[model samples]
Target: MFAVDTSPRSRTRQYSTSSSSSTRSMAQRDSMDIDSAALLDIQRALDIARNTEGDLDHSVEKYLEEQLTGVWNRLESRPNTYVLSKDEFAIFNYFVGRYQDSKVAEKAIARFWSSYQDTGSS
Candidate 1:
């Protein structure tokens, strides 16, 4: 006669590691802040575009254009008050490139930065 043994194995350690890793990932994704109102606004606009618009390219461009209009104007008007630090500029450029063509986004950034120079601000 042949006998087979079946037993339950403990999963406490495995479960804890997997659970904690997943929780950490969730927290990271949920708490993505860039420390700038304009950056946050751009993020919101991107979220809206991704969620609501079926056309990814068109929606990104249109939503970014609409949402960032006031932000750009504010930055232009009060260049000293709303200075785009190097990090801030990198973040802004990243979003614009993600939503549109890199070449076009570069041109737009150039123009926007020119406004800061014209205003004699940083």
Candidate 2:
């Protein structure tokens, strides 16, 4: 038999296994959604990379510049905006490491990534 407490502070409680499982499932779903969005963003960057055929460094520079421009505009409008998620940033870093010969571009992207992290935003 189960008992219910009507007091202001009841310490004992029973939780259903199904309820806990559902909560876990919901959290997993949220994580997967974020991952899926990040993947789509990375794919868009890859398509941009494929379209431009030239020196890899130049191509990466152009791609990063465009992304930075878009992020900058969004930031101008919304001061608290997070430009990209951690996953998306990781993929961007991978591309930057692969074809970035210019230190300036590297520093700019790194600075942006750091600020994004500092914002403690989603």
Candidate 3:
């Protein structure tokens, strides 16, 4: 004669393993989703900038004339506008340090932008 026995032990073990694996899978998926979303946002911002003719060298003069003027005007109007953040300061310093001439800096920034896209697309 043979007897079959059923116990909670088997079910508990199975449940634990499944739950742990599910959690791991969910975490992995979440990470991947976040990465994809970030990439999409960056792509969208670049597209808008590109569409707006924000190329560094080609549009530098216009950008400087328009955007900078707008920014200055806003700051002047606001009076209490926040000072340049760290990143803004860094960018300003980089341009100032890299090229003595504003024209040269404009050209270099444009070239850098073009090269960045070229390398990234590949």
User: Candidates' lDDT values, in order?
Assistant: 0.41, 0.42, 0.33
Report the candidate with higher lDDT, 2 versus 3.
Answer: 2
The Cα RMSD in angstroms, rounded to one decimal, for candidate 1 relative to the true structure is 22.7
Q: What is candidate 2's lDDT per residue for 14-101, written digit by digit as tens?
A: 2111122343333233323343223223344444345534433233345455554544443345434334444334445655654377
Models sorted by lDDT, best on top: 2, 1, 3
Name the runs in model 1 displaced over 4 angstroms: 1-41, 44-55, 83-91, 95-122
Candidate 2 residue runs with Cα over 4 Å from true position? 1-56, 81-83, 87-122
Instruction: Give candidate 3's error at residue 82 in angstroms.
Output: 3.7
Distance (Å) between predicted and true CA of 72, model 3?
Answer: 0.4
Q: How much does candidate 1 score in TM-score?
A: 0.28
Better model by TM-score, 1 or 2? 1
Between candidates 1 and 3, name the one with more favorable lDDT. 1
TM-scores, one per candidate: 0.28, 0.27, 0.23
Per-residue accuracy of model 1 over 1-122 as CA lDDT, tens digit each: 11111226211111001122342332223223222222233444445344542333343355455435534454555544454533335446545645465444454466557755766663
Give the Å error, residue 50, model 2. Answer: 19
For model 3, the superposed segments whose C-alpha errors exceed 4 Å read: 1-58, 85-122
Higher-ranked by TM-score: 1 or 3: 1
What tens digits encode model 3's per-residue C-alpha lDDT throughout 1-122? 11112323221100001122343333233323343223222222223333442222222223333433333343344333323322222333333553455553444345445654665798
